[model samples]
Target: MKGVVISMIVVLAMIQFMVKPGQAISCGQVDASLAPCVPYLTGGGNPAPACCDGVKNIKGMAATTADRRAACNCVKDAANRYSNLKDDAAQALPAKCGVQMNIPISKSTNCDVIN
Candidate 1:
């Protein structure tokens, strides 16, 4: 019984790290040429026009190349810059929702792609 209880607790703890918020924050208001794009994955209000534009633009950039690695890199870069992703959410975002955020890495690269 003791071992079973301990195992359950460990599993639940691991599960917590797997959870992520619905959305991310955006980078519209900021300078575009520098950072270019930001994510509004935090899910509070509708992302600003610029935010949406940036994402579209990044997506376009990624599509242009067959590698598409840039798209994932862009998303990861954006998440690190715009969103306050920390701890589990940050980790999970890169791992589970990397595509959603446009990043391909399964771990936080701590990239400063944005200026």
Candidate 2:
């Protein structure tokens, strides 16, 4: 009985370390943060100050690989909804907003591959 209890405790401890932490950001949060940038992404114009703020907010929110992947997936979904999204403009958005994204913002990017 003593050995069985000890083994169970060890297994539980190992499981704790094996579990990945949940992402801090949600898809809804990602959408809210990036919504301000839609105009610049679809049309040719400088990104608004609010848009840049949103970009910076997203960059700050994505602190882990899981968070980045979630954000990437959200961005891809949003991009897919916009038929007029300019690829070049979308790609340049981060830089234009003075934010550096770890993951590429495009429909083609595989969110699962991001680490």
**Candidate 1 similarity to native, TM-score:** 0.35
RMSD for each of the candidates: 16.8, 14.8
lDDT of 1 by residue, 17-106 (tens): 453533222222112311312232443333445445543443443433332444445445545655453434433432232234343332
Local accuracy by lDDT, each model: 0.38, 0.78
Error of 2 at 9 (Å): 48
Backbone clashes (count) for model 2 = 0
* Residue pairs of candidate 1 with colliding backbone atoms: 23-41, 23-42, 24-40, 24-41, 24-42, 25-39, 25-40, 25-41, 72-102, 72-103
Shift of residue 67 alpha carbon in model 1, Å: 4.7
Residue 21, candidate 1: alpha-carbon lDDT: 36
- For model 1, the local distance difference test gives 0.38
What would the per-residue lDDT of candidate 2 be over residues 1-115, giving only the tens digit for each residue? 9788557545644543454556367666666667667789999589999788878877877889988998899889989989999999998899988887886778788899888
